[model samples]
Target: MSTKLALLPYAAPARYSRDERLRITRLAGALRLALNIHPGNGLVMVLGHGGEKNNLEALETWVQRSLEAQALPPNRASLQPLLAQLETYLTHWEADK
Candidate 1:
């Protein structure tokens, strides 16, 4: 006789750990490997603002440090599109309240 596993109740989305976030960021980066503001880049900014109020300055600082440490150049020209994407993400963040 065939038996089925017990059904489990639905649960909320699992919270991501630091490593999980990093992994996700890396994967995102890979998908947009050519972009100036890829997932790897956004990951830092996203983490800083996670579950907290929006802090543009803090997000900017985190992005700057992450890029600088990696020896990436300071080029806002390449960053504009990414900035726009971030703004959109931030809008959704605010709406979650």
Candidate 2:
């Protein structure tokens, strides 16, 4: 005779925590950044309505803080591209000024 083991149903991974969500919301608010969570596209859109250099810097700082504080939840890899785009935009914007 053999012993039998039970199997459990698998569940989807958590994409974000409540605390992290709130933190992201607050940061976006403070930076005047608009966020669009598109489930269809699976993207957290950060629409920046142009601001001063310091404001962009602040956004970058906040993002870094989120990573450091372990506030980045699932699909966190997406943030890297966003940050890179932000930096590039800021650089060109500054250059144009």
Candidate 3:
């Protein structure tokens, strides 16, 4: 028996639930702000040959920070601002459509 790992197609778009979308949207926005990255740039996933990506070092820093945040005691004060921002973005998204 042999074990193999298959690489999925790069162009495929995966489905995400509304909550999942909102969570990631907020995370990306916060990371962009923290790292001072332009709106046109900074994503971990490279969609194609010329896709944008966050600063590699900055992204690593974000990962470490997020993991650390999760490990700490729940603090609503820390998350409230991000949640508020997410709510504003989501509201605007609906209004735009």
Candidate 4:
């Protein structure tokens, strides 16, 4: 039998200021564009590996370090929340394996 995954609902917290929400949205768009431009990036590979916990951990660590090194963009402070959102989004697909 085939199982269908339900779509995850996402609503930004009310505590986030309007500017913060806009920043998150912009960051998300940029990420989507980058992923589209480079289909074989590590993040895509990790997600395609069926949501293994270790893969997620490795990706998170790499991303955190990259952010700290200012290799990504914006700033670590701005990107942290987006990273959390990405984690939650990916975690929702864990059952697809």
| Strongest candidate by lDDT | 4
| C-alpha lDDT of candidate 1 relative to the true structure | 0.41
lDDT of 2 by residue, 1-97 (tens): 3333221122232355677656555554433343332223111222221232444434534454444445454234646554554455444544544
The list of candidate 1 runs beyond 4 A from truth reads: 1-57, 65-73
Candidate 3 global lDDT: 0.40
Clashing pairs in 1: none
Best by TM-score: 3
For model 1, how does the per-residue alpha-carbon lDDT over 1-97 read when each residue is reduced to its tens digit? 3333221233343455677445434433432343334333334434353432333333544444444344444443435444444455555554553
Tens-place lDDT per residue, model 3, 1-97, is 3323222233333354676445544554564565455544333342112343444433333333443444421232435454444344334544544
Cα TM-score per model: 0.31, 0.31, 0.33, 0.31
Whole-structure CA lDDT of model 4: 0.44
Q: lDDT of all predictions, in order shown?
A: 0.41, 0.41, 0.40, 0.44
| Tens digit per residue, CA lDDT, model 4, 1-97 | 3345443232222344566445544554454554342333545444323242444333433343334344354433556555655555455555455
Backbone clash pairs for candidate 2 read: none
Ranking of models by lDDT: 4, 1, 2, 3
